[model samples]
Target: MIDRADFLARFGGVFEHSPFIAERALDVGAVALPLTAAGVHAALVAVFRKASEAEQLGVLRAHPDLAGRLAIAGELTEDSRNEQAGAGLDRLSPAEHARFTELNTAYTEKFGFPFIIAVKGLTKDDILAAFEARIGNTATAEFETAKTQVERIALLRLTAALPGE
Candidate 1:
């Protein structure tokens, strides 16, 4: 609906600090005018699916871990901050924080990427359970799983940023 530049500006971070997905979607006209959030998200998902393995990995790696260093440092992007906070990740008690830290370290060590989940409307318990369960996934399986989670996160962010879900 709006011009290309404006669309890019509004949805640039829908992919967790990545804008190339939006740019590519527009460049290829995968997303036309009369842009709805679902349309944009669909286009972006197409872009993501076509991305090289390394690029996909980069996108996954770009996300901050739940209740991890960036959240502790107060350096999470606004969307990430709010999402984590909504999940009560921002208010963890010391024991909970330690458990999360331990799980995060073990998961990353095992999977070669941070544990990722769509934190929107999830409880901290839910996240921890997911982390614990998903940590046992094989590397190839986990990679695909992480990418799926990233898409879910992008969809949530896009829904919030754009006019409709």
Candidate 2:
């Protein structure tokens, strides 16, 4: 029930948590020695204080496996982009599954990370097609692509967390 003005004033600079959430997260992170879920909630509450639901999901949507096209190889992992995209296309209609299977293997071989994308709104075929198209991209190109995807995810999470945001 904290006011937006008060919350924003206290914490307004963060790369990850947006302005308000980041500040509270920092405060809670600074002193969670008591170790309670409430402490965690306090930190998260700051994130949600002024955000929309989509923004909140943005932070969690990131794909951890994709590498930054321009990022050091060291930064690459198994899941880099926001893994979620459109929701509920699990039972891919035959050809869709095959495409995903091929793309998944090819992408993993090329970049060493799962081709990640937000799948909340897209179909499995679409996600697989992106992977296929991206498989043809150069490492540097893919790295930048992944970075952009990550930013999108973060923004989504941020918007969701803000109270009236």
Candidate 3:
């Protein structure tokens, strides 16, 4: 079995800035030997899903706005930075940036959290379209959608961290 600290050190950030998911997974005996990316992701997601609504909202709120201030200021976590950059979010023109900013603000105002997506395979335009489409969803629908996106992001991160598993 991997040491608890070591496992946390490697997998903690799989859930954006929330290391508590990994910690809670370990507490619940989910970090068994012969760990695979899928297994670890499943365990962490279970804990995340089981979290209180307030705690889940905290996790969603922890996410940085896409191509927003954090990206402009170079403050996103490494995984988020790379993911956004991969989607061409780092090279937005001023008009594009303005639109993203507007949408981010509106989305946050409506949903009480930053827009979240698994950007690994999406283009900037695709993200914007999704942002616009999702903005019209009901608060209850958006909350569940954001949680599912968070899970997708975590799984992608885990796969990258544990390639070949």
Highest lDDT among the candidates is held by which one? Answer: 3
TM-score of 3: 0.97
* Every candidate's lDDT: 0.88, 0.48, 0.93
TM-score of 1: 0.95
Worst 10 residues of 2 by lDDT: 76-85
Put down candidate 1 lDDT per residue, 18-82, tens digits, no spaces.
Answer: 89988998888899656677888899999999999988888888888889999989999999999
> Would you estimate the TM-scores of all the predictions?
0.95, 0.46, 0.97
| Candidates sorted by lDDT, best first | 3, 1, 2
Compose the digit string of candidate 2's lDDT tens values, residues 1-165. Answer: 444465454333222334545555555553243323344344555445445645644442333332223122344221222333223333455575566566666776786555656544666556656776888999777765754554454444444444321
Residues 57-156, model 3: lDDT tens digits:
9999999999999998999999999999999999999999999999999999999999999998899999999999999999999999999999999989
Q: Is candidate 2 or candidate 3 better by lDDT?
A: 3
Per-candidate clash tally: 2, 46, 0
lDDT of 1 at 10: 89
